[model samples]
Target: MLRIWKWYERCLSIHPVKTQVVSSGVLWGIGDVGAQCITYSTARKRLQCKDAEQECKIDWKRAAVTSLFGFGFVGPVGHYWYEGLDRFIKLKFQLRPKTVKFVAAKVAMDGILFSPFDLFLFFSYMGLSTGKSVPQVKEDVKRDFLPALILEGGIWPIVQIVNFRYIPVRYQLLYVNIFCLLDSAFLSWIEQQNDAPWKRRLGGGQGRW
Candidate 1:
């Protein structure tokens, strides 16, 4: 593990953007595989797939599409975002790095700004890539976005607090990508749960925003 991390560090130093992109892509792809497995299990149990030989079939295309999101958006954007965010906070607020104020501001801004944008993009991209029309995509986003944001809201701020306090700016995205392994799965699971009862209840009460 130490050796692998050292090797990763070396690669990161030599080629930051490329490394972030590739790693994010690979991890998100793997996360999608996990999501597929989870979705399959849920379906199998719900439908009572009694065949002993029944197995979860991985969707490589979906995984690739999910990976493209990480590669094309998260990696490059996250890299610059953290870098610029750190600089901006330092300059704009004059809060010293690792200070409580500094970390709190980062967490607040990240949750308020970037998290929503990221989720919006992910849902929109997924819908379009899968051939949904603009209106359909908008509906998908509406159905999925609020629930996702609310659930993630409970978790990510805590994660970012630790990240801003401990992780270096350059390595923060890597740390996030690590957690994104699970996050991607969760998001995929949420997306796969189309019109689920809980989703209807959550989205039902709120009229179109």
Candidate 2:
């Protein structure tokens, strides 16, 4: 275990961006795999497959695309964003680390700026990746953005509070990536929009996946 850590640290030192991108890609791929597992179960139950031997095939391409997104966008962008935020706050506010105002400021900026943008990126990218027309992608952004943002509001503020106050700035994005692995799974499943249990539970909201 320690040897693995040493190897990772070596890679991270050599090329931080590349290492992070790869980590995000693999982690996000795993997330998509998890989502696929749930999706398969849901499909079998929903379809009431009579043949016990028949199994749903995993969509490896979906996981691949998810990894691609994480590699190209999420990890690289998150790294830069967190570093820039740390610098900006240090320069602008001059608050000491872990202070109340410092934590609040960090959380506020994340909530106000990054949350909405992150949702936009996820839906728009997924839409384009799945071959939706430009207009269609834009339409998807509108239909899903509000609900996603509402949920993010309920979820991320508290998360950011802990992240900002406790985790060091250097490792913040890494910390987020760990959480985001699971988050990506949920996002993947919800993005599928094919009679997902949550959708049915939420009264069957209309969404074009």
* Whole-model lDDT per candidate: 0.92, 0.81
**Residue lDDT tens for model 1, 12-82:** 99999999999999999999999999888888878875762387778899999999999999999999999
Which pairs of residues clash in candidate 2, taking residues 3 or more apart in a chain or in different chains?
none
Best-matching candidate per TM-score: 1
RMSD of 2: 3.1
**Candidate 2, TM-score vs. the true structure?**
0.87
Question: Candidate 1: how many backbone clashes?
Answer: 0
**TM-score of the candidate numbered 1?**
0.95
**Model 2 agreement with the true structure over 49-103: per-residue lDDT tens digits:** 6863377677899889888888988889988998899889988999888889988
